[model samples]
Target: MNAVFPTLVPDHRCGFWTDGADELETALRRRADVLREAAGEGTRLLDLAALPDGDGAFDAVIGDQCLEHAVTPEQRLRGQHLGVLSRIFARAHALTVPGTRMALTTLTAGRLPRSAATNRALVDVVREIPLWRRCLRPEDVAKACGRWWEVREVDTHQHDYARTALAWLGRLRDREAPLRAEFGDQCYAACLRAVQTFAGAIEDNQLSLVRLTLWRTDQ
Candidate 1:
């Protein structure tokens, strides 16, 4: 791990993977002595459902809460990325050999039925969020993976997500001046707003946090 990503601790090595320009993927790759393609993007990355090519070579794969942010805006509003979600699963399946392990933590949405609509909490709070625009119900994700993997467990982290969001808000508050200085006042304000809204959505059950585990199968 040290040779691959000198800056990262083992705990974060697997869960936190991102290659966006703002992220440190490039800098980290330069620091790596053994790991290759640590900064891969587009066709190179083992991404959020990015990296369309999967070679059935990996022994394990893990991802943090990034899938929601990677989908189209239309899918975000609808509770799943209709056009791209399955493609992501298929690509991932192609990459993983049988019996490989996979884990994913993602933001989830309420499983409300369309016909009997009485819960107004979501309507009152769920506005057009820019960053965390998309969400998936656990079943949707499970179905996507069932063809290639066996579902093992699904766990909810709603309350934890709420607390985590609040903690972020607190940290931003504590570092308001420095954050404003580096990222600008407008950016800081936007961060605050996004966190607050996310916290609220988690509390209202309109948004949730989930962890899912699967085992790649012979199928």
Candidate 2:
């Protein structure tokens, strides 16, 4: 797991952890993360379709860099995510109320068609991110959630994402020796390459780090 952005807030019980791996529960707990996983449990989002809508259980669900990796590295897994976006949105709708919303941040495609360089960058990213992803445009996501929510705002942080990627790449490279020792050479290389790919994608306008805020509508 890329501990780079683990969504933990110090001196506040504002954030909670929800991951599929039971092994991470202990680690998250140690970091003062309100662990949502028990000793034996599955991911809440995976089987979210089965559970009845909470109808206001959560204040909001933040899909931070989560949607892009919703599809696994294998194409067969894409069906479970891209094709079933409604299920995911349904779960989100069920979790919040009329006024609450889902705030999502992920990689989204721009209006421009992808160039060859951009396509190549994507290949490197897929290899490093280990996900067979479908780039969902911001509008596409809004349409997918149309039944349950409204797109209140869609902000593109293109340059910022590019800069952040470069910064992360630098920080990661600074610790390359230890990272290589811990994660093996291939994994370390992949992580480094992924950051480079993202920087390229953001620079070329092939991708943007988007903050899409969806407001709940009475459905």
CA lDDT scores, all candidates in order: 0.55, 0.55
**All candidates: TM-score:** 0.63, 0.62
Q: Best candidate per TM-score, number?
A: 1
Note the residue pairs that clash in candidate 1: 54-95, 55-95, 56-95, 76-134
Q: Where in model 2 is the C-alpha error above 4 Å?
A: 1-56, 72-83, 111-118, 180-187
Model 2: what TM-score?
0.62
How would you encode candidate 2's per-residue C-alpha lDDT over 1-219 as one tens digit per residue? Answer: 244222111111111223433223343243222112210122233222233533545554456556665544353234444455666776777776556555665667665534777677677566544532555667657767857877777767676556555656676788889877877787677667766776776688877767666766775
Across 1-219, the per-residue lDDT of candidate 1 in tens digits comes to 113111111221112223433233433333231122222212322434445442546655555566665686676566566446667666676886655666667777775534333344333224424434466778777766657767787777676556556655676688789777876776566556656665666777877877776666774
Question: What is candidate 1's local distance difference test score?
Answer: 0.55
- Per the 3 Å backbone cut-off, how many clashing residue pairs does candidate 1 have? 4
lDDT of 1 at 44: 29
Clashes of 2: 0
